[model samples]
Target: MRVARTLTAGLLAAGALFTVSGAAVADAPAGTKGQNGDPTEAGTSFRTATAVKQDQKATADGTTGDYLYWQFPAGAGQRPTAKATVKLPEASARHGAATWQLDVFDGLRRRQACAEGEQTKRVSQQDATVTLSCTLRAVRPYAERWSNDPLPGAYYIRLTVADGPDQDMGLPVHAEVEATAEDAGGKYAEGGELGAPLHAGAVSEPEDGWNGSWWSDRWLWTVGGAVLGALAAIGGYTLTRRPRRA
Candidate 1:
């Protein structure tokens, strides 16, 4: 009886551990990038975009006509959203606040419509900064119907200062871009890599069953296997034990 109780306790402990680990894994934040550059030049691409947080610091000056670009992977049945905050220098009587614009493009360099959130904001002299965000509803597996709309692949974000001070372009501005995807609970297809001329082999694969908690899954599997082994041992012991004679 004592051995049975011990085995039961072990099983319960293993279950509790799995539950805790699963919760921790689900609450973790998604990946991000921190890239800064003048994307105004021709043929500029996100070949070397840096990994950054949902909120990151970037620089843009007037003279260079600076623009920032970031690329994120999206899978079928997933809806991606991108948000950005642009902080311009203190506004003066001579220098008005800057106007910023945020545009989202698909792997084919086609502009995507925003399903939610504002995509443009102007930072007035009174205000220090402004925010622009956009969401791309369900990225279909392939172009469907008459619309040759965007398909799942590398999504890019472009942030540019639409209007601002022409002189004294040395003033530095802060810009941040955040990207997120929500699962739509629909069937997903096998993921693939971005096509040629871009990042040669950059792939946008579907989120795995493990999400980002590979270690948690490993621990759960380990504990579960141990529980099963213990149960088997207890069963064998019970079957092998003989009843005592009076």
Candidate 2:
């Protein structure tokens, strides 16, 4: 009889779990490969782009007309952001207003749209610095080739002078670039997952292990609570029972 009661309790809990959990949901492993203190030099092209730590700042030196490039890793459910600051050589070296632009691209080399930030800024010759930023849409676990939805992969950052005075072409400049990602939560898990995380060139996985993500941590707590309740109820009934008359 006691065994029967336990089985009944188990069945009830299973039913609740099934009712609440809609489907098999997962996210691309959180986090990605990073260079850490990696490099002080920026790549001039996608072929030579330098890698940067996800949450740390990395600096590089370059000329005014150089196309500086950096790369960082991002995973599903993450909304990654990129920031770059360029310090010009000297106001006297520049001839006129110069336009600086920051661009972001996915592993597939497709440009990703920024949700916020002034990606391009036109600074006067007298201006000392140009700061630009870009906040990308939350990464999705999966997307069709035809669709442009953000997905997990190695994202690239490109900073260059879109328009500037000829005199500024070869002037020395200093640039600091940083990239970070915030947990966008698990809403994108329903999109399904990529066959493999997108990797370009020499990029490789980091220390963070790639594993399936839970649909919601709340579901685990719910299931745990229900099981505990069932066990307590069974124990209480057994202890409170009166001795049966022989």
lDDT of 1 at 40: 18
What does candidate 1's lDDT look like per residue over 1-246, in tens digits?
Answer: 999999999999999999999876544322232245222121124543433322333333332246666666665556778887766666663266667788887766778899998887766667777889898877655544467454656677787777767872556666656777776443333234223222211434435321221232345567999999999999999999998999
Candidate 2 pairs with clashing backbones: none
lDDT for predicted candidate 2 compared with the true structure = 0.78
Maximum-lDDT candidate:
2
Q: Judging by TM-score against the true structure, name the best candidate.
A: 2
20-120, model 2: which lDDT tens digit per residue? 66332111121223376446777778766777657867788899889988888887777889999999878776788989999999988889999999999
Off by over 4 Å in 1: 1-64, 92-94, 168-170, 185-206, 209-246
Stretches of model 2 off by over 4 angstroms after superposition:
1-38, 204-246
Worst 10 residues of 1 by lDDT: 208-217
